[model samples]
Target: MIQRPRGTRDLLPPESRLWQAVEQTARAVFGAFGADEVRTPAFEPTELFVRSVGETTDIVHKEMYTFEDRKGRSLTLRPEGTAGVARAWIENRLHDRSHPLRLYYIGPMFRYERMQAGRYRQFSQIGLELLGADSPLADAELLLVLHELFTRLGFDDLQVHLNNLGDPEDRPRYQQLVRETLAASREALCSDCQRRLDENPLRVLDCKVPSCQVIVADVPPVSTVASEASRAHVVAVEDQLDRLGVPFVRNPRLVRGLDYYLRTVFEVVSPKLGTNAVLCGGGRYDRLISDLGGPAVPGSGFAIGEDRLVDLLPDGFKVRVLGLRRLYLVPLGGAARAEALRLARDWTRAGVVLEVELTGRSLKAALKRADKEGFAAVAILGDDELAAGTVAIRELATSSQEVMSPAEVPAWWAGRS
Candidate 1:
């Protein structure tokens, strides 16, 4: 038998309800922050990511699912959300409307890598991008949005790991520092870190290999080499976060894996998800719009790995499934079944959840089935009830029965606690 591909999942039944809750909560929080929802294609020209995410980043170099179309044009499934949204902002000329265009998106992203807990080949991300803003407060505001969202979702213990990548002017000097430090310990570095030392030395700090981590521990903080302006920006962001009561720690080695990030960078980490799993990561990208062919615009955003988040949800958290009202209709005869179908239609149109039984069953058997299926109320229709144009409604909880017109059933159910 054919099976689902590896690193993918099928969301079924009540589990899907949980996913819906996450999305709904995200929408409510994002909407309150004045961010309108935006969607982009699942795939785009291969060069879009290569140019925006950087050639040496793991996402572009190893994880992207790139292929050629029939016309021989290169295409790739999006590995992340910000680049696509930035492209749309540039292509659609959203900059013409307002100085800051707040946008949010939630959908699947593709990447090819070893499947681990909370990591998959096909994953989902909920992200928000605030475009046309370039201030330390903008960075703090994004962090506040993330903190509010996770808190609302029942996470009380979360650490916001903060850092500064410095502006373009400061990056070269930091890069040189990283190169020299890693070059001295090149023999002890992981294979990936060894290659990164030559191509993009900053990425070596992001390596998880034990030996590489040790080598990076002695390296000086990026802030040491950052220009005065970049250092001041970090101070401003920290001051705002303090004012907002959003606790964060300075991790000078916290350079994000993306090329577009400049100045502010951060990750919200949850202790519940083990030592290394970050729930969300984002930062300021002041030049991304221009890099993607639009006029110069500043933007900052973060993407939450939905899979990891769902796993981290509190055990007592509940999702109320809308439109499943636990009302069942059981008919004892052919005429009663026909009448039941009619009532089902009317009740459904009136926004009542009703299930009509098509299979013929004795009244005793029908009531038993309703009880077994956890129906809150069962409407029994027999030839006598049909002739009288009414239904015998039994409250499953109390085992009490009442006769009411088909039209009155909706009101009666609605009035029940």
Candidate 2:
């Protein structure tokens, strides 16, 4: 038999229900915040990511899934969501609509990387972007939404690790500082960090290698040489967060892997997964649109790694979503089976969650199956009940049974629910 590719997964029953609940929660929460959904192609020109995410980032340099299409033009599965959003903003002329477009997207992203627990080559992301606004309030709003989302998901141990990467002008000075500080320990640095020292010195701070991290620990925070204007911008963001009571910690060494981010960069980490596992990461990318050949429009946003989020989902949330009550309908005899569909349709129209037993299994077998599958109750329709215009309802938990008219079953189920 043919097997599925190594890095992909089939989100099967019950487990798939958890994913649906997550997506639905995201939609309701983001929609309440005035964020409309925007969807782009699963694949785009290879140049899109290179131009927007930067040439030196790992997403572009190592992880991207790029190939030549039938027309011999390079195409790539999107490795991240932000760059695609920027490209869509330019190509579709979204600038004409309104200032500060609030858009959210949930979709699969592809990356060719080594598989790990909670990480996949094919993964999904839930992202929100606020475009065309540079105000500190916009940044605060994003954080508020994030806090609300995690709260709704029942995550209590997550933390926001925030830092100011400064404005574009301050980058030259900051990069110089990193190079100078790590110069003495250059030989001890990893091969990746040594090459990044000249190409993109700030990338050295983001290195995960134990040796590189030790050397990078001594470098001065980027805020030390930040331009006065840039410093003021991030300070305002922090003040707003404080006023709003959204908790966060200032981590001097925090740096996002993408090149477009500047000013406010952050990652939300879960102690349950250890500090290295980032559940969500995003920041302000004021120059992304202009860099993508569009009018300069500032934007701030973040993407939650949906795969990992579900993997580390709180036990309470899993139980609530997966343990929702559903009724099993058992039809006895050929005549009862034929009439079952009509009753099932009527009850479902009345907002009842149920499934009719399609197979001709015996009543004893059907009840056993219902109990094993955790059905709240079983509705039994037989030749006698069909003739009498009534049904039997059996509560699995209480082992209680009641006879009622077909129309009354819906109300009874609703009451129990």
lDDT scores of the candidates, listed in order? 0.88, 0.91
lDDT (10s digit) by residue, model 2, range 5-114: 88999999899999999999999999999999999999999999999887888788889999998889999999999988999999999999988899999999999877
Stretches of candidate 1 off by over 4 Å are: 319-325, 345-351, 358-374, 395-402, 415-417
Clashing pairs in 1: none
lDDT of 1 by residue, 1-417 (tens): 999999999988667777899899999999999999999999999999999999999899899999999999999999999999989987887878876788999999999988788889999999999988888888888999999998888888899999988888877888899888777789889888888888888899999777788889988998887778877887899999999999999988898899999889999998877756699999999988898888888889999999988878876554344324578898887787767777888888877777778778777887898888777888888888988988898988898999999889888888873
Q: How many backbone clashes does candidate 1 have?
A: 0
TM-score quality measure for candidate 2: 0.98
Question: What number of clashing residue pairs does each candidate have, in the order they appear?
Answer: 0, 0
